[model samples]
Target chain A: MRVAFGEAILRLGEEAEDMVVLTADVAKPTQVAAFGERYPHRFLNVGISEQDMVDIAAGLALSEKIPVAVAFAPFMMRAWEQVRSTISRCNLNVKLVGTHSGLSASDEGSSHQSLEDVALARVLPNMTVIVPGDREEVKEATEAAVKSPGPVYMRIGRDEDVKFLDEPFRIGRAVVLRDGSDVAVISNGAITAEALAAAEGARVDAMVIHVPTVKPLDAQAVVSAARKTGAVVCVEEHSTIGGLGSAVSELLSSEYPVRVRRMGVNDTFGESGTYRELLEKHGLSAPHIRRRMEEAAEKRDR
Target chain B: MSSAVELADLRHATDVQKLKERIREIRRSILEMTSIRGLHLGSSLSCLEIIATLYFLKMRHSPHRPRWKDRDRFILSKGHAAPALYAVLAEAGYFPKEELRTLKSIGSRLQGHPDLRTPGVDAPSGSLGQGLSIGIGMALAARMRGSRSRVYVLAGDGECDEGQVWEAMMTAAHLRLGNLVLIIDRNGWQLDDRTEEVKRKVPLRGKLESFGWVTYSINGHDIEKIIEVLDSAEKSELPVAIIAHTKKGNGVSFLEGTNKGHKLKLSEEEYLAALKELEAKPVCE
Candidate 1:
């Protein structure tokens, strides 16, 4: 997934002369090294300092440059204050790419996993938070973030070669994959692949909505889906408290109240495990989402 | 041509006496604003001359064209001193001097911290120890665009305690950002205690030098000395760090050299006394 982002940036860099890529010494893992290797002058390694990288990105933005600062998802927390004060508060044109999101870091343990980044990034004013589910969406989302003005936080996972969507990708727009009226299975990020499988395996006619942009959330699409199905199930590889599940529940409870079941990490830190094992242990696998979807549909009938 | 005459007038306009008067006026404004809102009195007063010198004598910026591409950038990383920055910007005609009275008031552009919304403020800053990194970005951008613009970042010595500041220092040197000039207002005092008392002591000049910066130690209160050091820094081939030894609450007698003056609500009597002391002082010799 990060490789897709790197390729997209490299393509964008060829056209946008003012675009620069900055990393805090995680270029290899985030796959931004591809852009760096091609445009050596445009790429900068700030040497393991996320806060400095963030502030420097703001400075570049002020100078009329589109700067993309890439780092691990958990590391962005070190520079959250800079993101809030310098970039978001001033509405600078800087893109923050946090790769290896959720439990995608696998063996790196709880300290490396980023379960709270969405909540942190969403709270900032004028910030666009995006979590791309597949490889192609990662590329498209990177392009959209570069073209979009103001600050953008692109949360991606280390999961590679995930299934790409056939539907067109747009910022702040949700894609309805498998449309059905029985239950709405809304999910985002790397776990959307699991969500698709869950809907198919559950044997329930489910409307699967993939929300790429978390902030300025496609509320209209979510509301329409909730209205159509009357039962909603949200799955994400993030904390259940403030990820897509919370976002979906918040919108539905206010606009169109419905029976909603959120499937995600139940506010617990993830331990060291393989990505698949962690997903299964955290109840974010296909079977768990399927169970949640059935329960939500049954609750709606009751 | 008339452009030559305009340039001549600008040169003639900023004599030592004129600079002194400007500093005094800005100091007065800082006191007035702090008297009402009661914030950052000591640190703001400490860097009054440094801010005044940059605006009036050193930096190549026009209030008429605050966003001019070729203009120098100023970032106040130690944003607690925003009153001083606001005063200097107003003095340079970025906005009306009358706006200084509304400092920190609701709906005022003169926020408690410097923000880009305020004319002439290059970046939003109040959170300490982030400005150098931003300045480096601006400097790098200027280099990338083939522009000759410089970036000046003024940070507090106490703010240096933040690990990010050192990270920025190392990165700036590693990049050899000769267009970047970092001015540390070494006021020696912080809100809770003196900087040395709180942190392990290291010779600051040596630390910066070891970090690969072309370092200078200067008397921050002296406008002439600051101008001299800035002139040299402008010609350097590496990033410059000016450790400006400054006194907190510099101009006034009662509050000078005290951490308690960090932020305080001044009574009418104390405010009047401060104004008198500031007005009676001779320009730095």
Candidate 2:
């Protein structure tokens, strides 16, 4: 996902002279180092200063420059005040991409891992949040964010092992990856790969949906799927508190009432473990998601 | 260029006495804004001459062409001074002076702090310690675009306590953004206490110098001196930081030297007294 992000910006940089890249000393980890080398003049490495990086991106956006700010997912919130006050307040066209999001930083523990980035980004007024399913979608989302007007926040995991199921990327639109009518299983971010695995293994014919754009959610897609299946189950690599589940429930609880169950970290912090182990421990693995889907199917308001 | 303003028309751009009048006029406008309500008067008063010198002299801008690509950018890093900036912008004809009274009023474009919706406001800034970083970004962009424009940021001394300001200072110097200028309004007071009392902002010049800035200490109220340093700043090979020593609520007899009226709705007597004080004296003695 990080590599795709780096490649997408490099390609876009060639076509758009206004595009500038900034990183808070995580150029290699975020994989933006290649672009920095290719376009030295258009890139800035403000070491360990996320607030300055975010504000600088705002300033660059104000001057009609498209600035793409990348950093470790957890550190992006270090500049959350700047993100809210300057970038979102002015509604500037800056794209912020956070790599190593979620349990991908599993071996590094909770301090490095970000379970709340999606929640934080979702609340900003003008911010558009996307959690791509894989490398292809990360590239697509990166391109879409820069092309779209206003600020965008994307959370991508460091897992290169995730499956790439590319559906055309558009801002505020959800993609359906598998078709069924029993229950609608919605997931986003790298964890959607696990959802796909779960759908294949589950006995119930679950309709799987991948919502890359978490904010400005595709209510039409969510409501129609829920109406057809009579139940909805939301999953993410983030905490269930304010992520996909909360977003879906908030929308459906108002627009189309249904039995919605949330699947992810249940209001707890991540501990040191392997990437797969953390996802399994946090109930984001295929087995956990499959069980949730089966439970929702049996319990739906029939 | 045909759509641009005629710089030749602004004679006050060079004359010191006329510029002094310009500062006085801006103060009167800010007082008018205060009449509508609020006591952000002290910080606004503190940075007058520095702003006046830039707007009337050093800045390459046109109120008629506020978004001109080559125009110098001025950011009030100490955004509590929005009233002062709005006043000067109106006087420069960015908008009607009649709009001054609508400041912070519901639905007014003059937000309690500066926002781009207000004509001539380059960036939204009520949040402190942010202006300098924004200025650095603009400077970096200007250099990348090869535009012959400079960026200026006016920050409050007490506002320097923000770690973000120091972060910006370090980065600006490391980037060697010589095209950027930061003027710190050393007004001695913040919300309800002295900057020195609340947090020691002294040894400030030395701190900036150690951070690799081309530091200068000057009387912030001296328009001519402010102009001199700003003019010389263009030739600097590193970013410039000017410590402009000033008084809070400057030039007003009762409000001077104190942070009492940090934000206030003026009483009729206090309003008349402040207005009469400025009406009597056009410039500081």
Docking class of 1: high
lDDT per residue for candidate 2 within B1-285, as digits (tens), equals 643445543443447877787888888888877877875987788888888788887899999988898889999888888899989888889999999988888999898888899989898898899998899889999999899889999998888989999999999999999999999998888885888889897799889999999999999988768877887898998999999999888877788888875777677787789889888984646
Q: What DockQ class does candidate 2 belong to?
A: medium
- The lDDT for every candidate, in the order shown, is 0.89, 0.88
Query: Residues A162-191, candidate 2, lDDT per residue (tens digit)?
Result: 665756788889988998989999989888
Model 2 chain A: ten consecutive residues of lowest lDDT? A159-168
For A93-179, candidate 1 gives per-residue lDDT tens digits of: 999999989999989999999999998998899999999988888888998899989999999988646874987679899999888
Give candidate 1 misplaced runs (Cα > 4 Å). Answer: B1-14
The runs of at least 3 residues in candidate 2 whose Cα sits more than 4 Å from the true structure, single-residue gaps closed, are: A164-166, B1-14, B282-284
DockQ of each: 0.86, 0.78
